[model samples]
Target chain A: MITATPRKDLLLMGIFTLAVLTMPIWLAPIGASYPDLLQRFAIFGIFAIGFNILFGLTGYLSFGHAAFLGVGSYTAVWSFKLLSMSVVPAVIFGVITSGLFAVVIGYISLRRSGIYFSILTLAFAQMSYNLAYSVLTPITNGETGLQLSLNDPRALDSLVGVTPTSGIPPTNFFGIEMSGYSGFYFCAILMIIGFYISMRIFRSPFGMMLRAVKSNSNRMSYTGLNMRPYTLTAFVISGMYAGLAGSLMAVTDPLAGAERMQWTASGEVVLMTILGGVGTLIGPVIGAGVIKYFENIFSAINENVLHGIFDFLPEILQDGAVAVLSLFVGEGWHLTLGMLFMLIVVFLPGGMVEGFTRIYSRIRNKNNKNNGEAGSVGSAEVQPGE
Target chain B: MGILEVRDVNKSFGGLKALNKVELDVEEGSVHAIIGPNGAGKSTFLNCLVGLLIPDSGSVNFNGNSLLGIKPHEINQAGVSRVFQTPEIFSDLSLLDNVVIPTLASRDGAFKLNGWKRADQDSEIIVRAEHMLEDVGLIDKRNMHAGSLSRGDKRRLELAMCLVQNPKLLLLDEPTAGMSRADTNNTIDLLKRIGERGITKVIIEHDMHVVFSLADKVSVMAQGTVIAEGSPEGIKGDPRVQEAYLGGAHL
Candidate 1:
């Protein structure tokens, strides 16, 4: 009975965006030393948001999305090499190239759906990675990966007399530095834009058709709607998002590597999406932050950190605690992630969003019950007979 | 010219003939009913007409356009819409959303890229969908999920979805197969109302009461061949139809 009205959701999203923009200031005490990590968080959050547009809403789980991300990164790096060192052109090239890649992959993969469609995308991604690493070595730089080279002629830079001694010039936007704090802010702006676009798409008629296709494709087809094009559009849009994230990553770091296009990286986005909540708007962003946080912070905790935390315990217990905890941290991080994934899938199939909403509703219902009881008692005292 | 013309359509599944030299001509604004016993290829014929199944030979023409080797969506683009016997609908979407999809798709044509457009802004489509829903008496349940509707109501919702497309030919495969007496009567009345709207209808039904009540022309098929094609009264008294039904009492 609760129909989703976009106005309330949009207002909530606006507040969330405002909070995110001010988060660095709020977390300055704890996160002052980790600006790079925060930047990565925003970039990957953009990636996951784009992934969610296709996988979550349309129910098309694409395994080849990393190819788009890799393509974007490569395109951005090439833009820096050929054009100005500005991140704008690089990111635009990245997004456009990624969209092109998606159109091809989407056209083919969308012919079949479910597991077969997933496998098709996985195959395409693997092929792309292999090509980047070997076959397209001249353009992609192969195993060594594409990097900025000082020796390479940048016609625009030379003509403008803005040539740098370093092979690869640092990324900037209109003479404003794009690295460090500026880089993070740039990525954050892109993330906000990506998030807003996704929010709009989620409320659109096209979004409704995608959901209809997900719920009952046969029915939509019978209703005279061809589902293939809608699905392909979702795929391309998501690919552009992944491309944007990849482009930002390249612009922030000034390098593009074949590793970015790996199948495991593609799998990571899926994990982030599922862990957050498949269809919820903010769920992917939350999931991305959690997984990235674990990757950066949790993996950094070694045996020494474990021992330091348990220093108050007895000597015997302290040493034993560090040993046991080491089984989960550092080299055992994958095991921990695997276990967490399984637990989430088994216990909370709807993911973190559903869990939070459940708790919120329970608390609200309890408060309502208390208020009802209080009102009944007050009314009883007001009765003339009493 | 007939609104829907199926000329010499033939279909076979691995040497087993499902339909052989089947031909049909449905006039515009007429209720054409196809009735047959089990294994008479009634569903197969309907599927062929709607492009769900391709005939080995012959063409299905809708409004003068040949429907040979066309995709199902393309067939729909040609102004041929269908309602499945199972009442196929997007169960997760509301009844109003269910009607809105076909209305949008019909106007935009197949494979359009109108991203992020508001559905409410299309006043023409909204008015048509509202009118169709009103006719089907599903205006009250417009906000309810299509899946939550009763069996009879789901059928009504499916009908509304089909009607909103302004289809030149509405192919209904058993509009009232699993309904109770009251539901069946309601469906019959609904079909009568639809007939009054002046849209051509081609239905494959097993319900004799439904067929007798609404069909302007009834065709009887047995062994994938039309044994009788005439008025409902002619079909009722036809010896071949009686023989086909004699072996299959349910019909």
Candidate 2:
């Protein structure tokens, strides 16, 4: 059997890139808000990709990755306040801070594996959220969260001679306009790059070793391989991806909050990974888009919207149906998400990609059986067993 | 001088003395077989040699380098490769990939940045892995997943993985533990071929047939200490070995 080639992977990636670039345009006829929805999809897709590298390939399920994302956002905001208002420096600082945070947390948390590892990471993330909200009020601005203020001085603003009416500077990509359509495109490009990098890592030898470690750590150790360094490397790389996603988020909105570091947010990415397909390249993206779509679009559907759809039904059935269905949609959308996650885990343990591959293989197996039967009948005169 | 020299190695777990003042000398290019009953510290002894467990007191020297306090991976880097009782091949990886792992690790010293390079493009490493696979008669199943292989094939694959590292000394824990008669014979042949390659091998086995067929010198242990050391015929006639195996009536 021929193995998958890089060229084939590149072709698939090219198709995905084209699809992502044209999605807003394709969905524009439906609503003017499709672009904003697509932008959120791309950002979360980046976040999920990073999370997958840590949990999916390495088999180390981190439940505190959102902490790193929060750190990235805070770092970006700090950079904006202290240094230039340019998104470049802010993003770079954000990524670096996330890596630093990962190094510290990984050193301690990697001491344990399996569920304990997950708990340790979750605890650490909660601790980070607590600190950001309480202890680090000077930096994080406490529960109110950090937002761009008019009183804050931008030292670079005077050098560039761009005097703003309010001290709060608008988001810009190294002097280039990063607002409206361009900002969304910028985030889309970053997500595509992040996806490409993750794909490269998944196909790399280091990725193979990570998979091997996940399959059997004892075996890899006996082969004279120290698993710690490889694991730490995967963790840091994944953290960097999270940092990138967080930096993009800060750039998009120019605000940072402690809520982003919550353990629930970390668990959300895990949910996304499992819902889409954990090990598959594009599964996490699909998972992220689906969840984000539900969060943004589906959650907006209230009892009125439900009634609008069920208007053609009998009046008695419509009123009762809308009331009951309303409980499962909109603000109750998380209930739907939780149910979908459970179903995916129960029926499709390998996630959505495996489900798709299973169908593909079933068809292939059927065709092969048919060919075998035809060949057997054709050779019946020569040899009965053949 | 011996290639591997262990001096006054002692190990204990809780109140149990697993190994007490044990000394071993493995000459270069010689097959050394270690035989013992259950819980006789044979596995513990092997673990100590490979740095899995540090001896309370003693020094293990390989090629004049002290192995004390070295990690297992470092010990492997020092040209000593080990195979566990169970086939320790990376089950999820292809058989060829399993061999390639150690080949790359051995060349680059455990962790390296050569991950991004294509396996086929690493012609030297690929050639070495292929040759080792061919030697173990697993070239045909190189693309098969290690987990799907039969017990015998898995053992052969593990052997191939170790051989690819070009280790100075091979430490095997029950190399033929769960093999059929045909597989046992194939393993013996492979061991003979490996012996001819001039790498010293230390094997822990329960099978007397394997010990008699392949071992140049046998050291039998009882209760964490060497009870008898001699040739196969010498060991067979020894009263101590007979008593260890059969409750002293045969002795």
* Top candidate, metric TM-score: 2
TM-score of 2: 0.93
Candidate 2 stretches with Cα past 4 Å from truth are A26-33, A165-167, A365-386, B249-251
Q: List, residue by residue over B186-223, the lDDT tens digit for candidate 2.
A: 99999998888899999999888898899988888888
| Interface root mean square deviation per prediction | 11.3, 8.7
**Residue pairs in clash, model 1:** A149-A167, A150-A167
Q: Any runs in candidate 1 off by more than 4 Å, and if so which? A: A1-6, A26-33, A165-168, A371-386, B120-124, B248-251
lDDT by residue (tens digit), candidate 2, A1-386: 32546787779799989978887786567453465677777788999998888888878999999999999999988887777678888888888989999998998899899999999999999999999999999999999988887766677766777667754668788677566677788888988888888877776777777877787787676667788888888888888888888887888888899999998899889989988888678889989987887787768889999999999999999999998889889989988878888888999987877677667666666776888753322211111000
TM-score of chain A of each: 0.93, 0.91
What local lDDT score does residue A204 receive in model 2, on the 0 to 100 scale?
A: 70
- Per-residue error for B180 in candidate 2, Å, reads 1.2
DockQ of 2: 0.42
